[model samples]
Target: MSNSPTPSLVKNGKEDFHHVEGLTSPNSHINVGDDYANNVNAKIRNPLLGISKPDLLAQVTAFCKEHDLEDKTSVFRKGSLLAQHPESFEDIEELDEEDKITIREEKTHKWRLPWALYYTVAICSLGSAIQGWDNTGANGANLSFPKEFGIENNTWLVGFVNAAPGISGLMSTWVADPMNNWVGRRGVIFITGLFVIFPVLGQAFTHNWWSLLICRLLMGFGMGIKTTTIPIMTSEIVPAAIRGGLVMSFQLFVAFGILVGFCSNLVFYRIGPLAWRFQLAAAFAPAVPIVILIWFCPESPRWLLKKHRYKDSFRSFCRLRNSEVIAARDLYYAHCQFVEEEEAFKGTTLAQRAKEIFTIPRIRRANLGGAIVMVAQQFSGINIMSFYSSTIFKEAGSNTLETLLASFGFGLVNFIFAFPAIWTIDTFGRRNLLLFTFPNMAWCLVAAGCCFLIPAENSARLPLIAFFVYLFTALYSPGIGPVPNVYASECFPLSHREIGVAFSIFINNTLSSILGLTFPSILSGMGPTGAFGFYAGLNMVAFVIIFFFLPETKQRTLEELDYIFGVPTRRHAAYQTRTWLPWFIKRYILFQSNARLEPLYHLEGLSGGTTVEVMAIH
Candidate 1:
């Protein structure tokens, strides 16, 4: 593909510059005059675009001096030029052999990153495991804990005990904005780690239901902070091209923790009443490594940049990226994007950013989209399996041993299936994966519900129910499982990221709390058949909402998404219904090879106003 810009004059009296075709080159530049720039639809121009080589070099020199990076001015100049015209790197004759080789490797060997980046992501991912283990620990404990506390017969109290963490989590998420601002990402994570460790360990020694509830609720505070910060931390450090895969590590490790939790449940099941204690206490294991090693990892460079610690931000970037040139390019590019973000937001206070999350058109759209996915995740019924699978299996006619084994199978399937999303999330895209999986999951739920009617005497009844439930989990792990955190983390700009993510997670945990508190009653009143069928319908509802509201965000830089979300929600919805849906039928269902789908948002560059139809293809 050619990287050089081609000038195309549009009828609207604007100069347009077309780069390459397709979604791969969606970052094309557009040159417009001052009047057009002030319009609501005006594109955010790249700061370095349309500059002469000498002026670009001078800017890099000044940037280096201002940031106390004068020692790397030569590196900064080339890196800045490459960031200005990313697609046309080869055309820049100023780039040396080493720079060209490193840039090429970025594409060819995208996963060959520095050890420090991998270490940070790995440690952060441990937080997800802590969450997962905490969830499934309760799953196994649900069988024994209630009876021990004499609340087994009281479904409401039983549910309340189970949901205490989620209730506390909902309240804790509101503090995320200020906490992240005051303490930074690493500080919040470390403090939350203490909450996960001690409170979870306290679960093993609880003599009464209320005491256990207090411990779990205390743990939720940590859960809320860690969950809110981890995705944002991972997203800011990774490259945009592979960001979905990396951030989804949060989900992948959660799956692993769930699997381990099940293993703990089974191993301790032989110990009788005390097995529940060990299962609950085992969650603290994952948190230990996170709290211990977090200080060794570099803090988020974007957070540093937000604080105007340019030198520290640059140093942090150096540890996360493979080469100085790559780090310099990312740092400078992020700085440029932040400049635009600050001008647009104009409020440094937590209250102002929180307000912007709801009021600003672009931020509001992102909030809505992120909120939909997070809510959908809970409504998908996966958590029912995660938090109560043992109870569910027992209800389906399994003995205590059989129930533990079945729940273990569910955990294993969840963990194993999550592996595919590591590759498919970025390649197949988030919206496409969700759209494909929801209908399948709905039918699996219906199938599982139907299996309940198979008479208790039948030998195949339990296995059939297990099969369908596992099938539902298989569809979930690759689709809704990983997509929500990845999507919510990347949708908002840096200014509102902490608040925006906290809000989304707040929705997630609140719904989770409701689900945990109500599912036992729901199962009792509606029976497994009715309850499963009801959530199945909700799956379809989630699918429809996602189709209309969620825009495709794969491979787009965090800054580029401003334009994507800036397109009105109504326009996006209308295009999906009136345009893309018909095109999908024609192209795939009707077998029309020539069918073409128009892109919804046109990417405007720095210099001129060019119309580029970036096809929303997987």
Candidate 2:
């Protein structure tokens, strides 16, 4: 019960050094394993910490000159000191009231950001909308496109046409890395915008199954690249405190796009033989805003820094952040971390980095974590709803108009429920949300599937099925919906970010392609009850894997995560199984007030200078 720091202990013939516990009290001791200790000491310290003011000033001056930032020397000097000793900012008498006030406001008014930042996020979010719109557009068109193309009875071909985007996405996602390295995030997005537009419009004019498949395949190429880049762009620019909620805006807009697509389906439902054309063509509307407005936003600073364009990176940071001081602080800190990351993979080719994603322990762990979440998103069965809700409703015995209406209701519920994740994804934490929602989703799927067995004469049968399906969407919108992209985007080091994200998306789209290709058969062969029940079982499988493998990653900086993921998988899984599960049972299930839980990761610099203990309880 003492509040004093514990003496350093020796383990594995090495002295275990102490870090100031930032999560609880400053005086508590964090007893970490050898892996955590080695990873933390090697990668997680601030280089500027403990340097004399004169030496720090000299380094800042050299950085400014080297980066062509001489005009901001004063700001850099202050920012470097602030970054070095964030805990004692008030003690640093050199900072003016304005600077202190700005730092204070960061916590108080996290959402009150600059117009350029908002505009940039808005454009990126609009790009995300294109994805959702594409999905539901295909959903509505599914009812007519197969018949129009004379493939309505060919179940396999129908599935392939619907899955064209995902199949092409699998091929194109790997290209995201080189493209990102070559043209920067904005360029990749802009080019992908063209793919989103023309090919999507081409969907409206295709006369046969092969032509329609070709157009959708082209659209998938753009989707693969855009999906890979936009999340990375948003994750790189946003502040870490609000990163989850903001990056999750990607899913929110995807939900919004789904809603709009459903509305378009209903609006054009009466167009005689051509209703599917307008539904498919309307997906291009969201893409137009992305192409026109992307240039107006600043490029991602992290991307700039990756290319050694430090001056431009600083400017981009300024536009993204509220003040030059905060911008410089972030830029310099990121630069320090980037230097460490670069040293780890210096002179390596893209292939080498890709290899490291599997070979290096730290990078491999991140890769696993990101991949699990991405796979989980697919297995959650949300996309089945997005891609075939109208078909699903029709299968449930509704007329054509009633089917569209029910699909719209699902879209509306999906979009409306996504709003809660904006607040929850950060505060509730990523891993906790997944653990809480997966079981509920599993049961919802089961219940919806069970409703199909009810007598057709029973009036409540259809309504009950819709209710359970809507409930599943409600749970998914906040948990798995937003977490995957946000979690995957931030887990990898900046050096491996593009490739890492690309690999994760590759898994996502590949599985999506498989699901799309096979689901029609799954429905017809197994029927709705068996298909839903099969996916419901997957929900539990996903939940178990997540519980054992995924570590909580909320509120940690991108750099700080190097240590969190560095913890060996066996070690983290053991902690969760042995320590966390017992505590959860005692505290929540048994209502024990005296239950004490152990923390998994101890991280610093979450807010200014404070260290936080990342507990499994979230």
Candidate 3:
């Protein structure tokens, strides 16, 4: 008579019933005082008394189907599911290829790369392009801007112009976490767009050196915010299967922006007095679209869940995933992850959460890892070439035209090589890519330095130096270029990710400032050979540090990293880095074959303790 569905009555004591969570109707059986005693006497002592396990499971399965509760792992933890349904495994093993395919199709959703996702990701990644443009665009302007500003000979003035935005970026980066917390990721980006636009416009019009410097500093404020938030937002929005590539796509756009800026410089170069101003203003092109596109996309679903806006989170998740079932499943796990994180930081305030970054060993390690990648990215000398390619080329005995052409070549090579990274990052993986490319970067830098050591008049001198520079971009773009952003974003907990990334950016810009501000002086003093040799040593050092410390993060969920880093369980120093590549490749193949490769950790029976049994779906 009650609204809830009642368990079917046994026919001749053969049919069975199970007390399955979310399946059993609460109103089916209830009593008060003497009524309870009467009901207990009327029925068997155990609620499941006389019920067989197999029949009970059958009833529960029917109930699950009726209720649309498709998540089998929720009803039965993965280990328990397999253990209780032993016949299922036997059936699985005995199935023909066609039947196996049918079963796989029934169990897993087919993954299609959605257009909306790519559009959204590409739109968000424009921030990186803007970064590339703003940073390297100045390199072309530097040749002429110094003359217009009447600060051509002042090394300090040159350094200040180059470093001004970074200095502002470093100072403003501390606010990134707090602002991101206050405003959503989308809001922060929109704000960043404003900062990016107006200052760049100001740089285009400003006559006085002081006004240009002010514009550069203001631009940093926006850069700090954009650099920290975009990668985190990108990671959170996309599924783990393509997270590496999508996030790296942000870096890819950075390469595109660099190339675009280089082209812009060439077009504006012959235009005389206004060439430098137009170059400074060219940064506005990327920012305008970012501001427009962000409004059309959804805010981060994870951030929505954190804010307890479940309805909004679900809506956002649905838009991103383009599936109600997948969105619901993702939301369910996100809820669990959020609850766990909340309990961990239950009594702590924001300040306390900030302090725990250092106090907590796992978080501290994550922060350290993030720091290493950010610092290594800067020290690898990518930016030295990016921010001061003109200076380097000029020092290599190139005339003005040759120097401009060389800068354009550097940007083009950087842009072209970034495409390979999109595939290799998800396929070959983050740590392995770093290992493969950084040594090559070092070698190229060494070779570049050797070319500079040749006589200034030799025809081989500039060409060989340019070749090595191009080679460095080729090696660096596919490996180190994108890995740092992907690696740093992966290293922190969702709660800490904003601050973690902000801290990493702060360190990154600080180093950028120091290097960009000081590189000319370094080139002047050490000459091109010595300057590049110094970079070569640093790249080699980066290789060794990454080899020892960075772990393989391919194919794992953002939440899985918490455990991956916690106990040194699977992806630790104990396992050789080389072994991970083969293991990941095999897993990837199984995934593509629709094998439904669940993580063994999801089977709690293996460990026999309370653990986060997150099933990593392909």
Candidate 4:
């Protein structure tokens, strides 16, 4: 047989529309079932292809055809199409009617963030809370798992159980993004939520440590995806003014999750050995409600619109947007502006995207800074203290009664102090609290380390209470608690925010695992002083890194950060406040305390100082 190419139907030497298959998912830019699809579809085309890059597009269309896919159009000028057939840029479509309407919406009145945005954010936050609960709950329960599982003397096994999920989370970063870019956030949440329930249930049912370990790893992957993607979903749904608070809530939810985990584990732990499964199985509790809520949850309209799922995007907006027409109109417009901007940025792959982040000098600084700060959060010894607090109390000469009381107090303080961050975060801004908290965290570790330096038998009760109560929460609430997730998301591009944060969370859990694993070993080698002091040094290094790199992004837009940091002196725009610590020392304490004496940092302030004196400082 001759290996000949099929004849090109040379009678007329022409291609025919006869080869065209029946209708597909409608290649036009319109969202078929959405409120805004037809209009939006008319105005924009596929982001990956040009308005009319014919040569490149034919390739994409052919590939789509061969794959039995629709001949979707590239985002382009109304009534226009791509001119090319590049394998990557084919199947491009023009904006349909709904997309065009969302794009064209230019509202006269500014809209406050809708109340439903709060619910959406709150629910996203709730999912994040589960991740935190999973993360920090283990720390609280570490006291029980070792003896219960026959790993009582095997400290390394204990470490592995605690830290291994974090390792799994690191490798699980890429599942949400780009994938969700096509699938939409709601679908991913539904899928991811369902995925976690099975693993958590498996972990609950398993008797062997190895089986439990595998389940925990799978849970981490599921949780890591949620941690990364939730913030972006929350951010997208929120308006600019409250956005910081809303997105910051996701970070705050981590604390809330830990609080829940702590409380739940404590309750379940006290119920006896049978309760261990209940405590372990408590993992599935959050996912059940989340799955149901996600049923009512909207796909990220921005994502829906981006993927040419305009009807879904519009319906999403309709479901989440307030009943008021003005409010609905305003949200619709922002979506349009965002889509228009997205259309201008053509064909972004992983390398192209990463390169864009790096090419902008300040963005590079911000990205690296945020990444480092997130790493620093894990290294601040919170993990050591969290997983080992009960053990620490036990070792610090506390009997069962004292240890239980201390544990109760620890839970109370963490839950209570978590809110103050919400207030000060917006009022004082991110940089002030974060920078000030670093030195405090450093010294807090030093003080805790010093407790171990003294002979254990000689320790006093008051100082011991101080170590666990005021100092620990102070170190956590502002420094490591909120800053890690807040700063990480604030640094990246809107398009890449979820994926970037996913990796940051991956780093978060990775370090969390390392600390969880190493604490027992470090505890053995260095005792308390050597291990925590090592962490103190790490915090000091972190402060230096943040000082040089992290900028105040408290209330600014992502676009503005680039413009501000592009100039040398302009970088300090939002970080201009003088903190209370530096202010207290320089303006009041050094002079009043005499001879510039070392001012002790007691949380208690002097009441004797007159209102007039306080007024003068302000």
Candidate 5:
């Protein structure tokens, strides 16, 4: 075959219309059908292509004919057109439509985030704060409530009381995806606020441990839904450039809630026997505004797009974005993404969907990564230390007053360190931060555990334990604290995002429940060293899993990740461990001088649609 092949002769001894030979185009025009062609026409234009559609199509035909890929042209999917004939279009342009839009949008968009976007996300994210407050508030309350309710020495009652929210969170997490799918993300979040408010109020007035447990359980149910939806909702609203930082604001507020809960406990501790009641009730304050403010915010544009409400999605996108161009560009790509998803899952039923989630190699890998992230976050022992910080301090030889102050310090460290993630999540990339921090956390846990083995009579005992505990929070807050929430939310394809996130949350809650329920028993049986040692071991295991499994999700749009993880083809389950990614890591991430770096990540040949975009993050 020549470098540029000629069209084949027809049955009538005349030339065909210059298409690839094997393709059977019955008419002069290609009948790509309504869904595929319409989406490509409206949503797939890119100045970066530097060629007209007719020219590009002709070139693709020639390239296919030369390469004997003529049969591939008859099957048109969203990205398959480009993926099938990449060598033909290599010199056209470096960027895709999404990158061009990002470049054009750089100056056109606002310097400050739009107030509408800010307030909406800020208010919705308060649910995480409510989660933070509800989960951590119990810790302070448990210190005194156990004694007041005559369960201070009863380890089982204490564990049950502490674990209530997690148990309920697990149940609610199971229902969250279907609920969000049914009522929408906003509706689930709205309903969650009610759960947070009333349940916390119930705890405030409860007279017995069982009653308090009931209140905590209800609060957990609310948090379960809220936590699952917040990241999804936030990510859908923001532009890809800042989505990481903004979604991370959800965890930042969570840290703030932890701080508030601890401070509330500290102030209330000075009040006498009824102090714990005030601490539990204080969580209700943040919940009230979240309920009202969410009413003002539009439903997620992605969710609207998923429902095929195109006009509504466009309007919602306009509201979420800083400019008309950004909104328009993002909306088109979102539509293209949705259309591809629809085609991919066309005839599949619910049973098939579930089966595919487990059986499809890429989806399985993505879910496995998601589950690992959530489980790592839980088993890293952040909550173990968080829920029992006061107890841990007491075990380290602090008096009651010192323990309370030390616990407050833990919350402060958590709150303070979380601020840096807003920058690091986007700048350092997701996988790098996790790789760097998980080992630090493991070291801290191990070191802190060793502090407990020191004789109580030693002068350095209390300070060393305090230093390691505080360092643990400092290390954890920046990486494991926020990344898992954003990472899990971004890892799955749009079709499975809600259920994927919810499933991860379910894993989170299940692990959290086990950890929360077992802490008191673990403390009783293993002492502080054995408990911390166990967690340290888990963190090390998590580090290995993340290093080998989780791919970097920074800077890529949710749609772009589908190609990177091989969602459309299911070919590359071990994406991060593969060739291209390691080359990327060594050259770009490690800044290795000898490493070869590609200027653009040419995704044209990877996806199943011509509408797919190339991502150049550097």
Candidate 6:
């Protein structure tokens, strides 16, 4: 046997071997005759014929020149064009003061990249806490201020209280995206931090609602940008293995902020008239430390990379990863892969990309399910408890202290529960959890809503049902809260993940805004029972949809997620049957540890055509 006869057998090779994309041995049977060209297009279009392996490239080039296309220059990229690599990382370097910094950032970072990214995760959580605080605290203050300000029926103030941050956030998010592009993530935050004080001081220094509302809106907008940006930067800076867990810190902080706000309200409720203003002003307190500390924080390498300042991007990546050269390489390659994908589809509009997401069956299914999950969490009547828990408890017969204590309890529940979701999300898997108890959550809501329907004289059961609502809140902290963000964050092509999160969160907040705006009015028109029952029905529908449609995405890498969702057929087909997920494993997991290795590729039966046949060995 001529040891290597032409067209050696990969599809039906000597051995029926299956391997990942970057690592599979190049097909040895390719003919070196004047039959193909050696160029980028040729290589990409016909990678199956072995354009990558060095042994084949020279032979392929001879054939290419014979066909008049070989002399073209080729940019060598030792990685796939997807958002991640099978066995690679980003390029990073350590600083001169390496010993002190490396000991701190490398052995362990104080906060994970996501939590550390923008002080605003802490700030936004606090802002949201303040929203809850003001909503809750303002009620407590009114007990004293009702006689002080000589006003009654403070319900309209509720909408202003909640809507203020949201309205400002909407504007700030739009501006934040642009500013980060203009200056840097750090600079935009620093400058935005400056504006933060103007509102805090305005609220503390001034005495009117108009002044307060103006400051709240401005603070809300700034926090909105921070809320959105923190997740984006965290996802970029951290490793995928812990991405969800790290992001949970931001949500966790929000809960803490709420507790802080509530306690501040209670402490000040006993004080002079100036206390409410101080509480509002206290919201700005985080900005001061953020300004002090963030100057030491490095800009997001990914953001810097986006600016086309590669060196800065590289250095930023180095700092975030604790200066581990191995980790640095993985980061570099993954970043390169992401940047390539981003560049490949750079100019698609928000609307157009959003359409592609829901229209493509694979991506659409994931996106729709995630959106429903996010909305369902709200519809489970949790927001009723969250937004109006103090009122609910009071209606159920708690005094002011008891209600504030209840408010504190909800914050405590959120903080406590957020942890398990981070711990178990990747383990339980997204689809599996959603399939199991999500409907149960809806059922619990139904029961709680019905309780509200009973006559107030039947107050005995209201507390029980209200407690059930609190139980629902606890159920939510871990599973529902983190999973939707995790899945939505993972669902789209790497090229569009950021925008996807933006669009989804945008929908989330918009729906929240509408609900926040209307829930009080709805509560006024219909009793609490009727209001939450409607939401319960919505959750029931959401549950049915999730059970049938959502696919599990826990272990999959972002790069594979791109392939798993980008192509209409392959997207769905990824889960339709089983093929070796070596590409996914290689790109996402092993690519870092084994840098010398190549990623695997397979047509996976119809990986080329649309049939379900496999290549068998001789």
Q: What is the lDDT of every predicted structure here?
A: 0.84, 0.84, 0.71, 0.57, 0.71, 0.52
Every model's TM-score: 0.92, 0.92, 0.78, 0.70, 0.80, 0.69
Candidate 3 per-residue lDDT, tens place, 421-441, comes to 887888788877887888888
Alpha-carbon shift of residue 183 in model 5 (angstroms): 2.4
lDDT of 1 by residue, 92-196 (tens): 787888888889988999998999999999999889998899889999999899889999999999889888888999979889889998999999999999999
Over the full model, what C-alpha lDDT does candidate 4 score relative to the true structure?
Answer: 0.57
Worst 10 residues of 4 by lDDT: 1-10
TM-score of 4: 0.70
Runs with alpha carbons beyond 4 Å of true place in candidate 3: 1-111, 568-618
Q: Write the per-residue lDDT of candidate 2 for residues 532-559, one digit (tens) a residue.
A: 9999999999999999999788877786
Q: Which 10 successive residues of model 1 have the least lDDT summed?
A: 1-10
Give the C-alpha miss distance for residue 77 in model 6, angstroms: 11
Span of 10 residues, lowest total lDDT, candidate 5: 9-18
Stretch of 10 with least lDDT, candidate 2: 1-10
- Residues 147-264, candidate 5: write the lDDT tens digits: 8899988988898888888888886875776787799988898898899888889887888888988888888888887888899899888766677888899889989999998888
- Cα deviation at 417, candidate 6, in Å, is 1.3
Which of 3 and 6 is ahead in lDDT?
3
Superior candidate under TM-score, 2 versus 3: 2
Which has the better TM-score: candidate 2, or candidate 4?
A: 2
Give the Cα RMSD of candidate 4: 15.2
Give Cα distance to truth, residue 427, candidate 6, Å.
Answer: 1.6
lDDT of 3: 0.71
Error in Å for residue 102 of model 5: 8.8
